[model samples]
Target: MSRRCELTGKAVLTGNLVSHSNRKTRRRFLPNLVNVTLTSDALQRSVKLRVSANALKSVDHRGGLDAFLIKASVDDLSPKAAELKRAVQKATASTAAAA
Candidate 1:
């Protein structure tokens, strides 16, 4: 409903536009949001969401938006899955000594 990304929690940011001449003006930085159908486990139907472009990129990078939503909707399993996945990733890192 709002002009915000539901998936990534991105919202419009208000600030001052500063010029080279030290002049400032009011401006707004809007989030890049798109209305999309996200698979919903709770409703057992595809739900619409306002998701940011970056979040969409994350989805795109890791297969697709559907895959990202499925991963997000899975409860109880996600945390453990994320932890294990991170651990495996960390172990595989070439710069382990640097870390």
Candidate 2:
């Protein structure tokens, strides 16, 4: 669909391309977006999302999908990701209550 990262909200940025003669032309800087299936330990399921390379690394650094989504900002997450985050939160809360 769109050229945007669902996790980090990384999108295409407009900039200038300078030639050898120092002439500037319009260009776009695209995010390195990739489709990945990340598993959520809280939800006990895997979800596929389009995310930037940096976001993928962040997810790994943070531990897993549920961990990353729990700490992620609502403004940066896409609609689908936000929904997933909510679901994970609910599941985690219920598990905490049960324990």
Predicted structure with the largest TM-score when compared to the true one: 2
The residue-by-residue lDDT of candidate 1 on 1-99, one tens digit each, is: 667666555688999999999899999999888877655332334555567888878867867544454455333223433443344344445345566
Candidate 2's residue-wise lDDT over 8-74, tens digit each?
A: 9999999999999999999999999998999989988889999999999999999988999999999
Q: Candidates' TM-scores? A: 0.54, 0.97
RMSD of each: 11.0, 0.6
Candidate 1 deviant stretches above 4 angstroms:
39-45, 64-99
The TM-score obtained by model 1 is 0.54
Runs in model 2 deviating more than 4 A are none
Q: What RMSD does model 1 have?
A: 11.0
Q: Local distance difference test, per candidate?
A: 0.59, 0.95
**Any residue pairs clashing in model 1, and if so which?**
none
- In model 2, what is the error at residue 83, expressed in angstroms? 0.2
